[model samples]
Target: MKTLKIGNTTVDTVLEWSGNLFDVGAFWPGRSWDAVEAERDWMEPHFIAPKDKSKPGVLAASIHTYVIRTPRHTILVDTCNGNHKTRKTIPPFNNLNTDYMEKMAALGVKPEEVDYVMCTHLHLDHVGWNTKLENGRWVPTFPKARYIFAKTEYDHWFANMNGHAMDGSFEDSVLPVVEAGRADLVENDFAIDDSIWLEPAPGHTPGSVCINLVSGGGSALFTGDCFHHPIQIANPDWSTQFCSDLAGSATARRKIIDKICDTDTYILAAHFMDPTAGRIVRNKDRWKLKI
Candidate 1:
């Protein structure tokens, strides 16, 4: 486990899994490795897997949750792919099991002790852990926590429940929470306290948000899918195929780069590999994440 401090708050990562999961070309359609060849030095082995003549270039990614402890609250930002869920479209995440809860226990926090469960969006991977299978029925994983969801984001998925576009997560992982009355559908700009709040960062999903945390003199942004890989730092215009709105996602990516570039604020991207938290800096005319 890796711990980070933002002023008086403490943040830790509960990793589900990580690896070179997707081919670079397929992840970002039409984008080639040459576009980011200049960054091969730092990208290899983490962001971009080393090249192999037997296969296409692949991008490294991690699925995990951030456990944030403020002076007054214990918060979890984006629940990673939960265990035993069926993700038909995303075969990599289907009906799997892992020691995710044990990892949380090692951090000295139990599921019931969590004060809030915040989802950046309602995507399958981001919300899978919202519920767990118990006796063949899905139930809220955090028995006593309030699960927060953006109103726009929730409504979008809620209306499309009849379909299976999201790999059946809307029904299995999210609905159970809502039916249990543990869901909080708030505006995109909802705030939790003086040090934390939500900021609208649409494009990846209509209701996707960036959770902002400011305390004492330290600051960090939990960017959910804003930039899946560090390569986006240099190529802000390359939106992944998963983004609901490609152009909007690209614009949001640029906005995030502009907000953190050459600054002390840390970026905790959802899918970035190890040493996932870092600051964006200017490299001549391009931007790079200094981890």
Candidate 2:
């Protein structure tokens, strides 16, 4: 567990996995190799995995959760891919096992101590930890936590819950919590408290949102898949091929970068590799993450 401070609040990172996940061309179809190579001096070995004889030219990402401890609550921003969950479409995340809970316990947070389980969206990776295996059935992992879901986001997926592989995710990861009566469907702009709230940030997903924190004059934005890699900061128009709405994703991505440029607000990226958090800076005509 690594900790950082935002005013009086403390933020801890509990990692699940970090390494090369996909090839650059495969991940960002529209991104030119020249653009990525230009940032090679800064991207090597972390954001962009350096060439290895065995596996060359791969893009890397980290899956982790931000444990935010406010005075009155222990909040989890986004839960990474949970253990033993089914992910057939993406083999890298399929039917896994890991010591994620043990990592959290090391940080002094037990499942029951979690007050709220907030997700930016209901994607397989983001909501996988919402429930766990129990008596051979999916059950809410946090006994005392209230799971928060954005109404628009939930409805979008719920409407097509059976249309694809994601239906399996909703069944195993999301439905169990809602069935337990521990879920709260709120507006995209809902506030958890005076200092913590959600802001509408669509594009990656129709109902995707960013968690905002402002305490003791300090600010940070928990970017939930709005931009998976730091390269997006430099090329805001370069939306990932995985994005369901390319135009909307580009629009929302730029909006977030514009909102944080030259500000003290820390960007806590959900899938950024090491040095996952940083401030946005104006690099001439573009924005760069100053980690």
Candidate 3:
């Protein structure tokens, strides 16, 4: 709801909601449902406790838009959920009706003024609003921007675009944009401009990446889905039960945490609770978010 400047970049946290309802002892691996009560307690102080654990974690359909004011051009990282898309299996993300464009306009960011749009991944929630409905067709949301995608991530998702049929995210959240000629697929550590770069961060999804912004005598990292909660700041090993590759993901999370803990970088977690962006510090031998 507010914009904060990090040197040459402006990070706007456009979020829907932030809570730890989903994994509060109620969530588990595919069939590994035995609640780890102690770990849950370890996670308590780091998360917002919801009375009801029967429901999924309530999250806002929001996007963290980054406006990089560099000498070259302007880039917007990640568009939030758009209106009227086919509902997802999750309740919180279902039938979203928020006005994302209006919020962008309020911040004086027009689609045309945006020269590039970068997506950390192509998940239904992450890339749902990357395109817009125009005259009965889904077109690139940013008319003048070259939509960037990780080459590996794009290929895998594109290959299975409609193969899954039922849960094919590419069909709804991606293909439309590719048809619109706005997608710009690049490498894992893809560098767009001088101050901004995308680091290869796999595990959450095959081609997951995080955005790094350098400016204002400071730095910030837009951790796509690497560390969803600040609790991960304490227990980086306690990955979500649904993570694709737990070991790989944990390694990546540690790497980023180390970099931020040592540098002047702040984190912009897409799903972190209040004090969304901050530094990482060592608590004993473990890491924690220094809010």
Candidate 4:
């Protein structure tokens, strides 16, 4: 649990989690055989392999939604896998636990207090908590917040996929907000207020956007799923097989690393081990997470 003042905003929190395979596998469609091999080839040295759920594998980072306190609004970036989310192996997220909300309250922010809700991409986890079960209806989680999304990302993911049947995210996480007139879809480089803006870091997901903040001599980049683990900082080219384009993801990593390293900005990774916030340092012509 570390914090960074990014740009004109304060990225106060990043929640880490651990769960069954279903919670993880659901995101990376081809996670089984390929991901295991990935663990052996690149992840083992820098990470710990999970023995079971109680001792969940660390590589599948249990990280989520970042709370950014901006000058004009309190923004939340990329809500993580939510409670009661249906999956293959992992039981739906903590159906009985109200801690996520509790944590928000402790920080003096209820969903209603959030002025803007921005998502980097609309993966199941990224969008899971966007809506909640209200009297048997899956309704917008942040009742008063405007849910901002990238137009390209929305269209690409909202489009039909190969084998998976689209669940009602279109209905629950997205459409309901739109129907309620709470959604604000914009281009990849959309700006919100002054201190915050979207960085179009595509490839992990077609419309995957990164949130960059700058203010008061501070800056940070909220990298959502661009590089899943700190291990990626070392082997930036080794993308998961499930990535939209492995080569493209690698290229994106190098490009992002170059930009951030050239600056004095702290990185807000959506996933990684504890003390997730760090500076991307160039170690002998290689990038490494310097926590």
User: By TM-score, who's the top model here?
Assistant: 1
- Which 10 successive residues of model 4 have the least lDDT summed? 160-169
Candidate 2 deviates by what RMSD? 1.7
lDDT of 1 by residue, 10-107 (tens): 99999998866767788899989777677877666556656662135677689999999998889999998899987778788888799999999999
- Alpha-carbon TM-score of each model against the true structure: 0.96, 0.95, 0.84, 0.82
Estimate, for each residue in 31-58, the C-alpha lDDT of model 3 and write its tens digit.
Answer: 2223222234433433434435423333
lDDT of 2 by residue, 100-131 (tens): 99999999999999999999988888888998
Q: Name the regions of candidate 1 deviating beyond 4 angstroms.
A: 50-55, 162-165
Off by over 4 Å in 3: 16-21, 26-64, 67-72, 162-168
Question: Candidates sorted by TM-score, descending order?
Answer: 1, 2, 3, 4
Indicate the worst ten consecutive residues by lDDT in candidate 1. Answer: 48-57
Q: State each model's CA lDDT, in order.
A: 0.88, 0.85, 0.67, 0.69
Report per-prediction Cα RMSD to one decimal: 1.7, 1.7, 3.8, 4.4
What does candidate 4's lDDT look like per residue over 1-291, in tens digits? 555655556676646364333223444443443444443533443333544322342244655678888767888988776666554433444342446777777777888888888988876667767877788877888989989999997888667532122244455566667777888889999988567899888878778888888888888888887878766777677666446777777787887898998468877777665556778887676667776
Instruction: Let me know the TM-score candidate 1 reaches against the reference structure.
Output: 0.96
